[model samples]
Target: MKEALLLQVETYVVDLLNKQLAATNYYHNAIHTRRVVANIEELASLEACTEQETMALKLAAWFHDVGYIYTDQGHEEESVTIAISFLKQQEVPEDLLSLVEQLILATKSEFKPKHKLEAIIKDADCGHIASENFIEISGNLMKEINAKNHKHISEIEWLQQNLVFLKNHSFYSNSAKQLWQPKKEINQLEVQKKIDKLLAKEKKKDKSSRFGRGIETMFRVQLKNHIELSAIADTKANILLSVNAIIISVALSNLIPKLDSPSNLFLVYPTLILMLFSVASVVLSVLSTRPKISNVAITKEMIKEKKTNILFFGNFQKMSLQDFEWGIDYLMENEETLYNSLTKDLYYLGLVLNRKYKLLRITYTVFMFGIIISAAAFIYSYYVYFSV
Candidate 1:
């Protein structure tokens, strides 16, 4: 019975989709249907729905947008009429069939949902509006609209529509808001940026007027230091690993076998010390190259006090951009003071880097010395044993 019902549903979709303009692109293709089904399934898991509720949710979600097969204007109502007729023919229980149609109608954006299932399906349908793909999907919709009517919208109209959706749209499900909202903001910003770019495609003023000499220098010096530090870390790690490998090879190949001899017992402690130091060197090498939390964060008081470098955005990701930009612009006008602030920041960072390398140098030196001294100790003890 279930097999026959699923088969009928599939056959209906295959025939209906081909005639629909909405089914042509990313906006309303089989992919959209598949995504709706996926979201409904996730909502079911999160809501702990019953088997009947699950079936109803999945069916309603799949059939909700089928109204696009008729016309875009009032497809919601048309979809309900079609869904009811199809379910009745399938002989799904009468109560279950009515619930499916209700779920479909509730998905219409203007409808006030009266149940949790309705809300879930409604949220799932429009959930993509807050996705990273929102802009791309909107572009596809714009193309479809223009192709159908051959009407081109003004740039202002496009921007206003984008702002409305960005400001007004909300994800009903917690998961959608949490995971998709951040990406959606990025999507909105992309369109906003394109609008900004259209007005300022070419520069009319001198480059020197737009940016200060020291500000440009800060960018260059900071970037160069970052690259150099990365290379140094890599080189340090390779040196440490190579030194340890040589110690381990000598130990395993030469010294490990002599541990079984009662006469060579004095060699035990030194051999153990050598291996322990080698292992410690390798571990420290890994840590030195591993990243730590960026040192970019600085307090507002630090900026106001001229103690923090306001040159990096990571320093003020929590601050209002307007405030940070104001402070930075003020500092930029006072060129002498700004360079002093940057010099201090670089000096402190250099101090930290110095401490890290110092510790690393010690670890490598100890490992190398321990291996050589232990090797000599083992040979000396062996010679004494044989000479005696």
Candidate 2:
């Protein structure tokens, strides 16, 4: 009966947490609560707690973080309140209920444990910080903090914060001190190593930016604009292509058949002229939108002279990776060369877009003139051959 009652309480806590905890509570959801419960079970065995003490500690672990669903601030007190109310509903002994409330309260990082049981529960709650998965768990904790507090923390800042936290944090239970303390120290050292590497990388980037930051930004913006204009040119070409295709289709189906009869012979030249202009327009439109591939062979000398643009695939499509990497490295090391490459890339893109638009313009002009001349020819033929 006692086992069944405890099982009921665990079920209720799991259900409540799953329902109340938002998706943004990435660290404090049901998974975390379950982990704490499992940790306490392990510690309870090692600490040699009595059966009643074990039950109370396990109950506290299950309920301890439940109040995170209600509020982020002063959640420990809310957790204690919830544990008391739930235990009362279960008709638990007053002494056992009070002990459970105390265990929940002891989980607050600021609160020092007043007894062995309290110490065990507190250490269990923080078991992940000493486990092999500390780094992954710590990342989730930071994400949860950011979501709950509406704060953004950089990787370096978070590592520094953990450094301070681990420095000050201590395991209260002898079991944790003996087993987890060494692992916790290892985690702290790894975090420090990461922080150092990140700092060095940032320093290098800052130094590199000193030489060509403005030029790089200018080139990036120009390249982006050129790409946008190229897209617009392609879209215009496609529109002309579609329009001319439809015109040719209609001329072939409807107008070409009429030319078989001598009575409709006057329509022959006009229809043929209309279809000719449309087919020509379509061919030009397709050329304007067609992707051009380079068939010319490139040599290392061209790359050395900065005449080849490694940024464009057509320029380096046939080059070996080693050669390409060497060319890229040379460009990166030389700020002037990098800027010149970007300039050439942007300039060539502009040239291509200009050609596309020029072709599209001619296509539209021919289409317009063909329609006008065809309508004039049709009207003149009708008046001369049939109107009289």
On residues 274-376, what C-alpha lDDT tens digit does candidate 2 reach at each position?
7888888888888888888787666768867878778889888888898889888878766556767787888899889889889888888887888898788
Candidate 1 Cα outliers beyond 4 Å, as residue runs:
1-4, 20-26, 154-156, 202-388
Error of 2 at 160 (Å): 0.3
Candidate maximizing TM-score: 2
Backbone clash pairs in model 1 (N, Cα, C under 3 Å; residues 3+ apart or in different chains), count: 0
Deviation in Å, model 1, residue 338 alpha carbon:
30
The positional error of residue 344 in candidate 2, measured at the CA in angstroms, is: 23
TM-scores, one per candidate: 0.47, 0.56
- Candidate lDDT scores, in order, read 0.73, 0.85
> Over the stretch 1-388, how does candidate 1's per-residue lDDT look in tens digits?
6656756775686467656545344366566776787788887778778988878888888787788777777887888888888988888898888888889888876886667788778778876666667766677767666655669976546666876777787766666667667877877787788767654432322323455767778757885796588578669878888978887899899988988998768788778878987888888777766655445555556666777766644456666777777778867655555666666667666765776687678777877777787778768877877888
